[model samples]
Target: MPRPTPSPRPRRLGVAAALAVALTLVGGCGTTSSSGNLKVYQQEQFEPGETFSRMFDASVSQTCEAARRALLSQGYIVTVLRPDAINGSKNFQPGGEAHVQITFNIVCTDDGNQGKLSSAYVSATQDRYTLKKSPNSASVGVSAIGSLSIPFASTDDSLVKVASETIPAGVFYDRFFALMASHLKELQMDAAVD
Candidate 1:
């Protein structure tokens, strides 16, 4: 007599249980949850002139001009220049084959006091890059073998961006505002003398 065959249902359930546990453990290894991270946006208080902005007692054009001069004084390459907006970028090497770039964006607008009062809003972003090398590969055709692919010892190097963050409002912005104020003052003095 042939023995009764065991049911496949039990074996299937065991496999399903093992798969569920393995998936759970693998999911927990992630640095962030599936819900993602929004702490940066949530932390913003949006207080007026707290960090990213300052008010100036001048016209919008004058304020933007001052911002331009301030960025140029710091050796930043001005990329965009306008009467009400200015953008500049500067590069820095902090060693270890790492590169950093800081880009400044400024916008000037009237402060509801006709053309006498204006506000200059500034925001800066810092981008960090690292050198990445990829090995060079060559594919050779041989009569015996269909094709053979080989990697050479030589590598191609490139800058790969790693991290980017907005510069928080602090001493960095404070010093910028101070310098801009001095430049504006000088411009006013020059105008008065003329």
Candidate 2:
């Protein structure tokens, strides 16, 4: 007996089913992550002595002044200086079209003993930028004719901030604190001598 041939309808349906499954998987790939990223705030521990603050044996004004000098010595531009607070920033161009800016903010508070003991709390933020180029557009209108729009072939380049974050506590903070301490010690010695 001769064998019968398979029907064309079933073969076509099989191909269609396979294609649908493949498309469903490919579509899922382009989907974005969930909106639960905002929950990252829950990760903050706010632990003490981790990296953002330290104590100094001086008045609030003295501690702030020492921080200012330490920043200036390292080529930071001091933007705000006060008895209890200081703000400074420095720019860096490591290489290529990348640029970095580090801004330091310091707050000094009297620990106790009529300003004889003080504490310094510092935080540094790093902002990263990259060069970006955008195309320019030109438009001209003539009374004799209709309005004309032209796209300029030239590119306009600018720096765009890409990322910003507060520097975590580590050797970077350690070095800064060490420098500030040295400056504070110098100030104390000068006062003692005078």
Candidate 3:
């Protein structure tokens, strides 16, 4: 007869023990660490510097035309127009009793490549007006049956422009200049097509 085979229970126990020891030996070779070299950095904000493009390529006249388009796109009414300057205004009613407006004036340097903008200064002013409501009653002379009376309701602005503030030459101007740049590009493209 062949040698008696080992019991299945003992064989299974031996295999399990060997596997646990192997895992322990393999795992013990590596060191666990908590501290890491990872770094956290915040994003840099967009700051308009002194050299920001207030003056750019294109002529004063063409740039003014581009400015007109830009302002119109932004719902501004172009009031005064000149070869080297533009003035526009936008209106807003934030509340039922208040009316606000912003006036935009852009003056471009007149020296450039006939159609290129060399330099420009843009200014924006914010003005607020309030609405007033007053009640008045007027009585006419007695009529045949009853006295004639009229009540008038009116709301009017003081017609005074007040508290105007000029916008700074920072992000607002940067954005305006960027839009003007794009508009100038478009004008060029349009001329090329023509």
Q: Pick by lDDT: which candidate is best? A: 1
lDDT against the true structure, each candidate: 0.91, 0.89, 0.75
Cα-lDDT of candidate 3: 0.75
**What is the TM-score of each predicted model, taking all chains together?**
0.72, 0.71, 0.63
All candidates: CA RMSD (Å):
7.0, 8.3, 20.4
Error of 1 at 63 (Å): 0.7
lDDT of 2 by residue, 1-194 (tens): 99999889999999999999999876665453355343345557778658587888889888998899999999999999888999999999997889999999999998999878998999999999998989988889989997898899898989999999999898998898899999999999999999
| TM-score, candidate number 1 | 0.72
Q: Any residue pairs clashing in model 2, and if so which? A: none
Q: Kindly provide the TM-score of model 3 when superposed on the true structure, using C-alpha atoms.
A: 0.63
Question: Residue 21 error for model 3, in Å?
Answer: 94
Model 2 stretches astray by more than 4 angstroms:
1-39, 135-155
For model 3, residues 13-87, the per-residue Cα lDDT tens digits are: 999999999998666544332343222222223466543337667777777788888899889999999888889
Rate residue 103 of model 2 by lDDT: 99
Candidate 3, superposed: residue stretches over 4 Å from native:
1-53, 111-117, 143-162
Shift in Å, residue 175, candidate 2:
0.9
